[model samples]
Target: MSEKLRVGFIGAGLMGHGMAKNLVERGFPLTVMGNRNRQPIDHLVSLGATEAKTARAVAEASDIVFLCLPNSAVVDKVVLGPDGIAEGAHDGLIVADSTTADPTETKRIGAALAEKGVAMLDTPLTMTPKEAEAGTLNVLVGGLAEVLERARPAIACFGRNIFHVGPLGAAHSLKLINNFMSMSMVALFSEAVVTARKAGVSVDGLHELISAGALNNPLFQKVMDWPLKGDASGLQFAIENALKDVSYYNRVAADAGATAPIGATVQQIYALANAQGEGKTHVPKLMDVLGRLNGL
Candidate 1:
């Protein structure tokens, strides 16, 4: 690694674009892989970041590679598939995954990378693309302490609050738990608002009470207010993605011989929404799905 770490970023989607931009702007030598969407990749290229044709190419050219991909499945394919990161990784290369992923799968990937002398860290992010653009995202990291320090500078390019939660898979586990809490709240709030609306209570009134109470939170506000204004893109997280996180959380609980009845119910709620053709809808649009379910 050079004095300024050579960084490669994969998945230049909504969140990845902003994160990569911050790293490049902060003076890291960045190489980014092209994505299906060229806009972000082109933007980064114009900002002095190099473009690579494949994940392997990116990994070959950088000391540390960052992944802001969509899910664990994609992460798996990108890191282990033929011509993937594992193929090009060198000793001392660090792969920092900022995706909310399955902890078990993350561990497997980490162990595989370890065999190649490539360190893998689960550094899942919180907040949204807006926060990513503002360089104020929260990063929950899981890996060895020394490895966390090695990646901290690049992580800090986009994360205002960085927590080293545990080792190997702990950050991803904590992310699932965090998403379970957040998405469950959205599910409960969705059902409550619909029930209240059917009983002639204004959603605004419900919002006021919750906003003034101990339950007030940024998720509650965005989930409630976004749809009220007929804009579901405020959260920028898909219902399907929320369902995936909750499902992973339930699996994590079950594997640990614990119960997750609430998580199960929340997963079902998002499953129902996804089944009703709202999978691609923003998570905040759960309100709309619940509304349609009750014939509102």
Candidate 2:
């Protein structure tokens, strides 16, 4: 097993497919496990990656492994369960997880893997699937200095601006803070647009005016463009993950003895949107929910 830093990807979703392709194209011997969604897995395999039958096979075949999962629960099962990576990974193997998760769970995973002679690095990513496909995702990392240095090259394939934020759980902490603000903005923007429409302003005009001046951002552009173009792919991001981040963000804020009323309110809004069966649509689809409520 003296291979040249072979890599394995445990998830091949919207983000993982591109990241794995980038690694394979760059000549890293890559292995990827097939997920329930076969398209991305097939795409990665076409790029010359070996397909592993299970997470353990991926662990047995690589010196470095990356997990781009949905949340801490999936991450826990893949890394700590019976046939998990930790169960098969050899000494000095590095497992880097790019999932947004609870800080305590991250710390617990780190400690458990450390006992197995494998180090766990939490390097949560930020941005949309488009950014991920473009290899411009931002990475906020937390880990030992040595492990971070060793993982930097593979991480570079997918992340444009990578930062070693701090140690252990710092990256997840910062990621929670960042998404709190992001989800809060979604709630605020949806309310503003729907309320403006009720007051006789067109949604397009509102987006144009605000986006041209002070209230514009990448988030604003993406959300406004999606529904405005009449494209509801249900892929922009879901209310479920949004609410998950909100819950983690609120918990983080509370533990620090700080209060964020706006974020709290937005969490409830997303919860309401999920209750209305819009949980699987883009977060911007909340505009429709708000629209009906405002009688627009």
Candidate 3:
């Protein structure tokens, strides 16, 4: 509630915008940058939040800056590029990066911030865009206990569940593993459904039976639910993002001297989808691709 705790958001995409709105509604001094998607930016402005002209401007205007970028490349550019936060950041500024990113890069940024007395918390988030809009995101945080404590209230504004997973980069590592599991499940189910349809089983019946059985999962209800209703585009999450996450997951596993055979195979399927130019399509688009492959 003091003037020293202003919060700024660097990305205003699907999840970023919702989190920013929650901060503003919670009475936090909020500043946000505009993105390619202007609707969310405009909405946040309507909520009594100021619009920042650039990533650095957001950092310069606030005490804590949150980066919700898509990947490490964008995160690097925003924090280290010309007019980046590292240049404009005040001493002791707390940066909470919510991107699902590489742990090594996270540590690199955290170490850089340390010299200036700034703190970095790699707090990646999970949940669909719908959950983000509902302020029910699950945040996995990795940082010093005291730093995470300082970030808790702001994090709680947008996340219904928040876990202090471990030290720096731990949250990102766990996020990669979690996404790999999710993507792998979608791929596995896609293959099974395609085979079932070919064998004269009803897709809707299979879904219903599975939902009533042990093989069911929340994602089946989420991605496949409306697809069952004949609305192909209701999921809204693209395969391109899934592929990106799996690729990141691969790197994390390789770094840890581990091999993820299932994850690796799912990445290949996603790679095939990308090659077929379905990268922009949602995860459920796999059904469309599978149907084509089956000559359905």
Backbone collision count in every prediction? Answer: 0, 0, 0
TM, every model: 0.97, 0.94, 0.95
Ranking under TM-score, best-scoring first? 1, 3, 2
Top candidate on TM-score is: 1
Point to the candidate with the largest lDDT.
1
| Stretches > 4 Å off in candidate 2 | 1-3, 232-235
TM-score of 3: 0.95
What's the distance in Å from true for residue 215, model 1? 2.3
lDDT of 2 by residue, 22-91 (tens): 8898888999988889898888888889999878889999989999999899999999887889878798
Clashes of 2: 0
Q: All models: lDDT?
A: 0.91, 0.86, 0.85
TM-score of 1: 0.97
Task: Give the winner by lDDT: 1 or 2.
Answer: 1
Report how far off residue 103 is in candidate 3 (Å): 1.8
lDDT for each residue of candidate 3 in 229-276, tens digit (9 for 90 to 100) = 766454666788889889988988888899788778889899889889
> Candidate 3 — worst ten consecutive residues by lDDT sum?
225-234
